[model samples]
Target chain A: MSVTVPSGFRASGVVANLKSTGKPDLALVQNLGPRHSAAAVFTGNRAKANPIIWSERVIADGVVSAIILNSGGANCFTGSFGFQTTHQTAEAVADALGVSAGDVLVCSTGLIGVGDQEFRDKIINNVPAAVEALSEDDDSAQLAILTTDSVAKTATYAGDGWSIGAMAKGAGMLAPGLATMLVVITTDADLSSVELNHALREATRLSFDRLDSDGCMSTNDQVTLMASGASEVIPVLADFIEALKSVCSDLARQLQGDAEGSSHDIDIEVIHAKDEHDAEVVGRSVARNNLFKAAIYGNDPNWGRVLAAIGTTDATFDPYAVDVSMNGVRVCHAGEPDQPREMVDLTPRHVSVLIDLKSGDATATIRTNDLTKEYVHENSAYSS
Target chain B: MSVTVPSGFRASGVVANLKSTGKPDLALVQNLGPRHSAAAVFTGNRAKANPIIWSERVIADGVVSAIILNSGGANCFTGSFGFQTTHQTAEAVADALGVSAGDVLVCSTGLIGVGDQEFRDKIINNVPAAVEALSEDDDSAQLAILTTDSVAKTATYAGDGWSIGAMAKGAGMLAPGLATMLVVITTDADLSSVELNHALREATRLSFDRLDSDGCMSTNDQVTLMASGASEVIPVLADFIEALKSVCSDLARQLQGDAEGSSHDIDIEVIHAKDEHDAEVVGRSVARNNLFKAAIYGNDPNWGRVLAAIGTTDATFDPYAVDVSMNGVRVCHAGEPDQPREMVDLTPRHVSVLIDLKSGDATATIRTNDLTKEYVHENSAYSS
Candidate 1:
């Protein structure tokens, strides 16, 4: 009931034999509304997938009729043929929904460099069935887009007379400038595409853009927001943005909790930074430090690693004036060992590291996961 | 025959009881100088260790008489007490060698935050014993500086009437700016301290500064070059720089080979970039990418990950115009799959990734190691 919690949306999941395990691998979400306004954000990676290239153009006109996504193949680096597959996917969706092909978006995920004739044929042949199975109450579309994710992530927010619903799928290759995940959000508010775009950028900047698990960007990441003006509540811009942020934040945490091969979900919160950018830079430096993550995995409470990691960043902070607290224990104060390391226990799955820069009031939190042997093994065996 | 391979230098290793294994953990290298001219480089990390702070000041006058180093403790983030320990150790070395305490450099490695009164007592007490055991032919100093390294790393370059010998110790926390190792280079060439400084900087910029094994910067990294001027041969600056570079490059490779838990030593060479900086940025981006490293560890030639990594960098390269070759097989040509991945065999320990940016003639190569399960386990258990 995630995306369907809002009115004027229909979604469906279908099996396309794309995944070798015979799981549902294709999904379609349609805006059955009087207003078909939309906005999107694609991966910052220069080497983008074909679907991303197509979807970027689809959102350029501020109008979208439907979005189609598939798993088990990224359709990246497949060259002109792969681009044709994405064009064909959008065309198929347009034909099924009786809309222009330019208004349909496409997304694909799995392994990179996989789009071939067979892959195209399966997606194209299964479109009608996916359209036939569309219903407002069906939540199976959330399950179709997952690759290595352990669970489906979805959230909904109820406003005065409007509502926002969202779904996200990501397990690895997560980093800043947006995690390697596909997000589809639907809202039943009477907002223009420009307004929706502004709200989405504001919301994702604080939520999805702060997750840096493994620090790997993907070629096929995208976040799409579609608005259908069935519930004719003209929401305040500030109120709509706040509601959207809550939904995005809820889904981002779910993604962090389910990151691949992770033992602990860690939050690196930097406080008293000179600016928000400096706070984010310091937090991300620690988030991407493998030594810090591995120390958390071993429950070592090694606060020196925290300092060592932040030392690499050019954030405006005095090295000797910083304080670090792990799990509420001030293990280090003014860059000197304060409490004994044994006083801090990292056995819980949720770990928090607070760093005070003693500069200004700006603060930021970056979410990451502990590095483990299982992470190496899973990534090594994935071959993507 | 490492540091003592050159004339006018005496080195010794002594048991300090600082190491739990009771092996030789303290080393001293003194310039029995006709001329004592020296230059050094310390870790660029802002949160530096006590020894790095001491050595950076000692090398300022370009007249280091002796250098003392110890393993089993890094003496970092241990507050004012740690600085006192480093000062005491240097003073003890100066007292034994009859030189100024300001002229004696200090270096420490092993775990961070371990400096205490007991640590100081062991190191200070062992200085005289190390000085008494000094011999020009004994190569024990190389073994004394090793922490987790399986074997000592040493190199020698004999010039026209002069010679250079160097020893380095680093197994992990290797990154740009410098590897997490202590290095001492000795030269018999009659050169000024300024000349040695120029040569040392130029050599290290291409050698130790290009190794990015784990992308973790250390707080105690230092590289020192001492000239004893015993050969009475005033060598050309170009020839001296070349000889120093050869020795540093040899030891850098040895450190790369002995990187902790690494299965493959990867050389990511980026060619035809707009400039050397762009090439290095692109190469280091790939070297530090965990996904690309894990793929190499699994013996999979996943060239798409290579493109994804370089795409994240601001380097001057057209994303679609890049070509990636793994071990001589061009897996991606012009950003599209050319040779099948099966054609590239990655089972060998030495793997080469050649990325042709097709933008300019400048090039650079970054050395790294494949991410493996053993790497995660080793780092997780190390606690520092």
Candidate 2:
């Protein structure tokens, strides 16, 4: 497995012993290139992790040499000690790569505020060995950044003369308006940080931010894109933007597929809303509805929950003006239930809800998954 | 099973056949002469049930003589037909009691958009028999308006000069900003419509609106308070306000206890917020958190989910200024983990979350329940 082989970068994953499960828990990625431009998106959660704070400051410079990521400890709500640990981890990575500490971004996920001095020491001591093992063909870096994920997620897309490859890790702690997914993208395109940052933000807004599985956001959610300018032929900016969105959308779908305790992936599409904001508001409300998700999990195409959720939004549309279609069957029309719920079979792994507001032409789409007993079991049983 | 034995009201429950289960599905209550002053609260959900629309308009006069309620099928999203059912139900109840139809209010709850011609016919035919059976000892009225509830919910508080008794039915479709708990209170006190309405609004804002179990607000939610004036001794408005709040609080607690698929009752208390709105915003955010609910269900004291939920709120406060206590154990403080996860035990059936915002004197409390597999099972298995 290789994480950076498709781009102008080197990466490595190491065992840091931060996790009691003894899995690969540390990863380092370095942009070994002449043009080092970067962009990032952080969690909107106010209680951010220490690594997010550190990485946000570092990524503000529009260039980064390396990113040090670790699993098992979120380093959030840890007071000054957690902040120090994030700083120390970044400094260690910077020292090994001979780059300024400010140029080294950091990210951590797992148990919040649990790492102690011993854990910090182990991470710092392993930095030299981790850096020495760095290679362009190492994909363990992506694997190391996983916490409750059952499998590693990776997506690669090739454009005219540029390439975009990305990886993410998250199983639970998912919701709308951004979830707990951590994404890292490497690209060999000649784009400025301003352009890359704008594109990444817009893409994420339409993709990852639309996912609402359990309506839980983690403190350490981060997405970073690095441009190494290795491609000689420049691709059109529009094509690059489309490719980026495609990659993010693919990763978002993969995350939904691997959602913890999820038996089905549900896509909520709101069309003909009064405006884009209203569509998003309605879409998110439907995405976070536990009853709707459970209905899908039970293979019951109950669209009443959809109506109830839409009723909570500020969307400018009469509830009576709405139409709901589930799995190609119209379950509701003009606000009243019209079709037999039995006609819509929901046992499939994927379900779609198309809500026509009968208002304006704005639309928004949200990706989510059904809630299952296994999700409750896994989340409740986990100590963190 | 007595619905109005504590006060000066006549009540009855009848089989309207709105449900396929053939259970007693309609309830009627008359003030039985004296002060007909009334106050009511409807669901905040923008997409309201048709009965809510009818009741909201009729109650504006604050001179209601009767309230007609039906369960098993919520007359929501039925468009004009739904509105007509509510109107016809009110008319039937009024004619049976030999009163004006405009003086009677209506409420309905259950599956949405399923109440059709058959339901309307059932109400029209059975209401006369129900009115003849009206008695203070009729407990069946309380039992009639139930869907998935495990038990009937009723409460009574006797004052010096007057008595207040209330009944409610809700198990699932519960969330903050008002769950689907239908409540009706009767008191034999002489109070003006202005005073009664004010008291009812204040009581519900702090009580029913604060209970969020599954974060799914139902289309059919209502709380009505009727003053019969059987007790000639009129008390001060302040005393009546206190009594109303007490009844609401009691009903709210019962609703939480009866939450479907819930094994533990969780109370989230937000203190030292900028204002009541801010505190409630933070409290509801935590109450709707699936991760935190799952953690409580698993008996794992994962307070990180609490912090993450609070982070989603726009309340003015530094994340680092927060302190959280689970049950009696201090788990987090100053935005960092304060106690070992092992030290915090969640074995008790009741859990408490105390969050100190350190912002102001205002505080708010929300009642919720842990997410369980049974909740998912019940919701998913239930048909439209």
Candidate 3:
């Protein structure tokens, strides 16, 4: 159903004056559970945000009772004061929720190097009202944690006894480095924190880690999985892992679809490589090729750019032995022209670009958004 | 002074019908010299163009009598027929110049996967006319190698009894994996092939290799230096290297200035890194950041994007100890805001961004272009 559909969870959102537009800028999600346990992943970028730096330590012991998120400032590279802002915000949230300050996770997204003392004070003062308004049916929490995204992203995959629910927010700086953006997934399934960590890693490794809508990696990306253990039904690890991956993949695709100013969402599948890593290398190269992405946006089947992108990688493939297909019409065969470029229809929102290395039996798929004039305009329009 | 300024060199350009625009599509530069020696560098892309494959072996012995360059067809990934086309083009140039095919270097630019039979015929059939029209004062050669470039890039360094001249063509796909795009530099100094190779490597290492305009590596990049040795002056090695580097750097800047659809030419300087490599790592990371580039194009002093960009690199630096300056105003100090955002003016084409790593004394500069709507339009307008 929704993020709040999971057992023993309540969410609410309030206007904290963090954003000048007067939109909801503060959000809270609490685990009112029989058992409180969580697993989380963060952006691998070394220069992380203050919130990420704080939550990394908070999640180390694998217990999280509440989460506070904001979309006004990333609170990244904001110096020691910004760290204090993140710390005090978590403390305020813990006080409101009757939880330990160390057991709260904080997430932030917006312009980098923001979140000064004034920003911190606004979040702390509004936290009590956000906590008082918490309800299982409130839909505003998901609306408050978006920076540039035009739509809210949420997904659910229910099993026979328990269900997993997820929410994410990102439209730019979406790249693959573990979690590409800020996300939260809640479940009622009974599982230990260790099992949740293992399953989260495997799920995100195959899902969010493969979604590279843009080549820009954010500094505040975090994906946290909180389990309430209120369903009283322990599921098989294999099934739980699959369900978690499905939800993550759903959110990943939603993020890709809402990428900033993108005209088309491209799925680059690199197959027949020497190994899975080689396939991933080739896929990422294609994903990062601005020329190829622009051509896709223009509905032009420019296979040469694809080959040129592939040439950038160290994947095992003879230059003359690779093949490329657009929408199942082979434009390049054995590194030469196969089908005419006019036959490939690319007007749809979803585009598939398949590259065959003809080296070994391995495959990888990378999700990306096409580079368009609108994307350029949207990203360059304002400071945010 | 132009590429023809070098002693014992003649240049000309002609229309071979290779380009549909009927512009000059073929260019020739010959060394009618007493001593013929040369050095060259090709693109590091694994899938190289046919001309690159041919000229690599032709310049093996460090002797080059003439060069035949064409626009409107990169002749890359055109299968075996493209290789044959390059081979035949060299032979045709050799037949017209009264030299061995092994002594002629061939260069091509334009769309990849071209150089089919018709395209190759246009080149092979026009060699005699191009040779007959060769004149030192024709000055059409530089105009022939341009594709998508708003202006021709040429530079000359006059010295005591010796000179160096060069011409380059690239508005896109200008990344550092060897010298990006097509360039030919001629020198009249009496240096051996070994000395020329060493000097060329050292000179280009600091110039063309530091320009990363669009972060797209080309498949047909070539930088060739032909020494006529006509001016029998054996200049000091260090002085000649400096002058050569000056010309290369001048050309690199011109390419950056004329980058496709760019309104701002961004110069990112990384200072106080651990070493030159670390400096380069930090500088290039900032140069390749689309968010930072877009902000520059928007005339916004968004220093946070700069910090976020450098954070992606593994260069030795504490994130909190960094300082970023825009147009001489320190916008960020100790990873916090310092100067006002309105203090920086990006209305001019030349924008300077300085990042102080506070790690060491090493420094490096990277030249890049801002991403704009016109860049997206031009790149997506045609298959090239």
lDDT of every predicted structure (CA atoms): 0.88, 0.83, 0.86
What are the per-residue Cα lDDT tens digits for candidate 2 across B1-384?
444855679898887777777888888888985788998887778888888888888888998999988887788888898798889888877877888888898988877777788878878888888888898777889988887777889988788877888899885323332235688988888887888999998888778878888888888888888888888868888888898889888888888888887999999999999999999899989988888888899888888888888998899789998999998788888987787778877887889899999999999998889999888888778753
lDDT of 1 by residue, A36-85 (tens): 99999888888899999999988998999899999989998888899999
Alpha carbon deviation, residue B329, candidate 1 (Å) = 0.9
DockQ of 3: 0.80
Q: List candidate 2 segments past 4 Å from native.
A: A172-179, B20-22, B172-179
The order of the candidates by DockQ, greatest first, is 2, 3, 1
Give candidate 1 misplaced runs (Cα > 4 Å).
Answer: A172-179, B172-179
Question: What are the iRMS values of all candidates?
Answer: 1.0, 1.2, 0.9
TM-score of 1: 0.98
Q: Estimate each model's TM-score.
A: 0.98, 0.97, 0.98
Tens digits of per-residue lDDT for model 3, B1-384 = 377888888888899988889999899999888778899988878889889999999989999999999998999989999999999999998988889999999999988888798999999999988899888665789999888777899999998999998998986433443223888899888988788888888977888788888788888999999889899999999999999989988988888888888899888898999999999999888887777778888898888888777778889999889999998899999888898888888899999999999999999998889988888887788778
Clashing pairs in 2: A77-B336, B1-B139
Q: Sort candidate 1 into its docking category.
A: medium
Candidate 3's docking class is high
Clashing pairs in 3: none
Return the lDDT, model 1, position A257.
89
